[model samples]
Target: MKNKIIAEKSGVIDVVIIGAGAAGLSAALFLVRARRSTIIFDAGSKRISSSKNIHELLGFENKSPEEFHNLGEKEIVKYGGDIRKEKVLKIEAISNNLFAVQSTNSFVTAKTVVIATGLIDVIPEIPGLKEGWGKDIHVCPCFTGYELHNKKVVVFGLQDRIGQLSKFLTAWTNNVTVVTNQPFAPTWIKKLSAVDVQVINSEVASVIRSNGKLKGVITSDGQKISCDAIFVSTSMQASSNLASTLCKVDEFGFAETDAVGQTSRPGLWVIGNANDPIGHLAHAIASGTKVGPMVTDYLLEYSLADLIK
Candidate 1:
């Protein structure tokens, strides 16, 4: 496919970016503004899809996730960048500083590549819990806490980070409960009791449901506690199996990136939740913006050296 003389033969684009979430769109905007030819390929499975509103996003407060993405798409097109609703199945470095991106439709080649594909949350196995996902069950307060203000909240603890996450959730809701299946609470969770958040150290047997809505959670001892919503502090794995197939991932399932988001392999870069330890929308946008100029600079340097040769 790389041998085919089509878009690459006509010099359609200089860089190809994967994922059209905040990170990918932000990078496309920056590159297009800098007069660099850029194309963005997006899969429809954005993490923000389930979110109602985004908070602390600077001038986009209380705006729906669709609203933010629409504005971003408009900005990218306004700067002469192209956005295609396609999923990238594979990415390979065909030559020095040249990459081939394969999708379901066609294959395209570019001088540089940026992968902003984010992560996925693996919720614990509990009955009726999956039904309430994104509606009454949430993972990030920055995306769902506004609607939960002053409401009864239950949080499932999967790690030590729950203590810190509980404090953040309290800013939007007063009534909060932390439940762990373990017999004893973690030391950090014990310390968090000083903050007035109730901690339950019992196994969750099931999630009680009524009329397709979350009513409460049942413990192994047959104790049912009523609550309005449940939050799961589960594990987050990077959505970078494609990237990992081509490169290497760290111990925590994050792609190892250089200062400019370049991976260990040439002609490949990654940003956003795929590489970030703390995956926030603001941080994702920042990482993409930072990588844009670096990619353009790399292309320019290579072009200049080629002319001298």
Candidate 2:
């Protein structure tokens, strides 16, 4: 659907949201309904766009992420929110309460800014892994565990996380295996054995697939282990430098915010994967919804102060 940009007389929006994902759209819905001039900049690279369907989100299970986002954008537009297809290039705090948001083609000023730009998952460099990603390859079973119930699942990747991840996978499958050369403490090994999860002390050299079906993974030692699916831990990387530039961020560039996504900068807020890398779809929606009133309040305060003056 084409966005109907609501022209503002002052040319300064009440809220400028730098994402069109679930979180950004949800916040736009609330703000637009509140009669705030909201503009959402959507670059359209949602983290879950690669997944065929979304899971763990009630009423949205098995639905395509694109469909969900389309519906969300429609709702926001219906409420008079402006949805821009451009990507925001930079955001500068012009005044204590105003921000200058520069996109590729144009720039806009906003009383408050919301950074909903999500994070990127740094998948390990393994052959054939990319081909089956979001299909037979997954990062967390929390989203697709039910589908793989009782199926053989191979776990590998980050040394600090694989042990726990393997154990976590046991919740949905008893046939779980961890392939990693990383040495685990005796207690950790015993714990995994207690849950009947197998551990192979070898690195995954590559993934094995046949006819678009994931067959298994090839270990570094030249042994192939058959599995229905593979789960690997990934390093989370911020998708945009906006968060680090505008607020206090970790080494990984994830913005550190208060419970409601309020960054160190007063008029700037970071939500969704921009702040919480491990957040799910539901969490993203909640974060967006949670930040809506705060942004509104910020704008309202500015209006009231100007009125007093």
Candidate 3:
């Protein structure tokens, strides 16, 4: 797993952590506490940006995503963790067994790397979706379902998938409607009907938004069903582009990892939604914290081996 250091260590650092979210920042703080010179490279775009408030986080049940990230950044900086607001475009294993991490405008070398870049939600085409997303239009009910009790909720998704929304919606309200842009399987249609869930076969032309809140979805035929919220199905893609070529990723683009966040490739670790698409914020934080000490141990061992050389 070790590569010979054939190239010179021109201006490399101790560790290069790619990402600065809850997971990345948590890892950075721990690494810095371990006295490792850690640098965090953040692209500044994540799946949680569209969310108004992140629930289930203790102490701050209604914390904004930006605030949550900023607080973490402040703490990391207080601990002497360096952060760069740049997009990491590539990470290649170079000569001398070091990793040359390349961003949009810069490159840095490190002994080990932590890829906590998270994931991106694939949004379908619908007018006004940009403004309506994460507001009245959402994907996970567990995140923002408290506001739709007993109200008309539209479940908009693909023909092949309606997901657990149809069933989960019933917990909050009995009034739930499923709308697939294309005709869905009769099996799903019948199953939904069995539970008193109405299924609509119509393509959406545009989403109706007022003041950045979702009103409803307008169909191609000029028909509109007024609803309090739209539970749209979104496909989650992992943000592992920088390490995908250097590591092992599944068909869904999520990097495969061991129990301690080590990827298939040595000296590289992955955590959070980057490795687990369905993982929550708590899971991401826990994963990052868990890997921090392990990364420190790795760098220490790596340096020890170098000393014997």
Per-candidate TM-score against the hidden true structure: 0.89, 0.96, 0.88
Clashes of 3: 2
Local error of candidate 2 at 147, Å?
0.4
Model 2, residue 293: C-alpha shift (Å): 0.5
- Point out where model 2 deviates above 4 Å: 1-8
Estimate, for each residue in 1-309, the C-alpha lDDT of model 1 and write its tens digit: 222223345564588888899899888888888777787888888876776667778888878889999989988887777778888898877766577788867688788888888888877888887777777888878777887898888887575667778777888988888777554356666656766788777767788888887889998888788999888887888875778866788765778888768888766789987788566789889998899888888878867888988
- Candidate 1 overall Cα lDDT vs. reference? 0.79
Error at 260, model 2, angstroms: 0.1
- In model 3, where is the ten-residue run with the lowest total lDDT? 1-10
**Ten consecutive residues with minimal summed lDDT in candidate 2?**
1-10
C-alpha local distance difference test of each model: 0.79, 0.89, 0.80
lDDT of 2 by residue, 66-85 (tens): 89999998888887787889
lDDT of 3 by residue, 191-244 (tens): 677777887777677888777766788888888987888887778788667667
Order of models, best TM-score first: 2, 1, 3
The RMSD of every model to the true structure, in order and in angstroms, is 3.7, 1.6, 4.9
Better of 1 and 3 by lDDT: 3
